[model samples]
Target: MNKDNLAARRAALIEQCAEQRVGLAFELNALRPSKVMAGLPLAGYVAANRKLALGAAGAALGLVLMRRKRLAGVATSALSAWKMARGALGILAQLRR
Candidate 1:
């Protein structure tokens, strides 16, 4: 091809690329976190009660730190209870069969 035709084709391709990029950016804007969050019911509630949510989170963290040992003990007891109950249930099932 002639230089003029080659240059014209390159310019056309560049213009097409620019248009595609602009279209892609516009499409991606809808998928942004803020835009997606705005559509969620929980997001709206959290946005409306931001202070309450933050306060609750802070209180939970404080409780975990202050009662770490107690929490660990309670968790261990709960796990043992669960295991015992599971074993009992298995025995009962075998007896039924």
Candidate 2:
């Protein structure tokens, strides 16, 4: 109601706002990685080994064309598993950075 009380209240409000700003900043910083990754595709992963992907594709095609059904199935499965593992490792490496 008085000048001193008003000033004190204003000071408290300012301090509270400052604290809130800092807390918000910290929270945003913590979420920065997730935010960055969200903007990226599939865990920020790309098949970097073009040669490997191409080779696998070629091998898969060959197997199919050769009419080796069982071998082609195994090769396809292995390639898929390798791709997944590579992606997971890449994500982990990026997070570590």
Candidate 3:
């Protein structure tokens, strides 16, 4: 068999062994018994909700990060100017005046 087929067979064998050891029946009927949802299929609904939520969240995060970066830059420039003013004042005071 090809490499892909061989890998798949190995995976199946491992899963079968694990299932047998765990006393699980080897059938699709072994699906989670408590997860049976009796309702109309809402695959489209789920997909739309996921798309919208992801888009909104990404936009919000991008805006917040951009604002944070802008504010940080402004703060750094202001602090630099303040330091320069203080240094100039100190130098002037040391002169004869």
Among all candidates shown, the one with the greatest lDDT: 1
Best by the TM-score measure: 1
lDDT of 1 by residue, 2-57 (tens): 99999999999999999999999988998786677887989977877899999999
Superposition TM-score, candidate 2 onto the true structure: 0.38
Question: In candidate 2, which residue pairs clash?
Answer: none
lDDT tens string, model 2, 8-44?
9999999999999999998998777666666566454
| TM-score attained by model 1 | 0.41
Error of 1 at 4 (Å): 0.7
Give candidate 1 misplaced runs (Cα > 4 Å).
38-97
Q: Which 10 successive residues of model 1 have the least lDDT summed?
A: 30-39
Q: Judging by TM-score, tell me the better candidate of 1 and 3.
A: 1
Q: What's the distance in Å from true for residue 87, model 1?
A: 46
Cα deviation in Å at residue 71, candidate 2?
11
State each model's CA lDDT, in order: 0.89, 0.81, 0.73
lDDT of 2: 0.81
For model 3, where is the 10-residue window of minimal lDDT? 32-41
Better of 1 and 3 by lDDT: 1
- Model 2 root mean square deviation, Cα atoms: 14.5
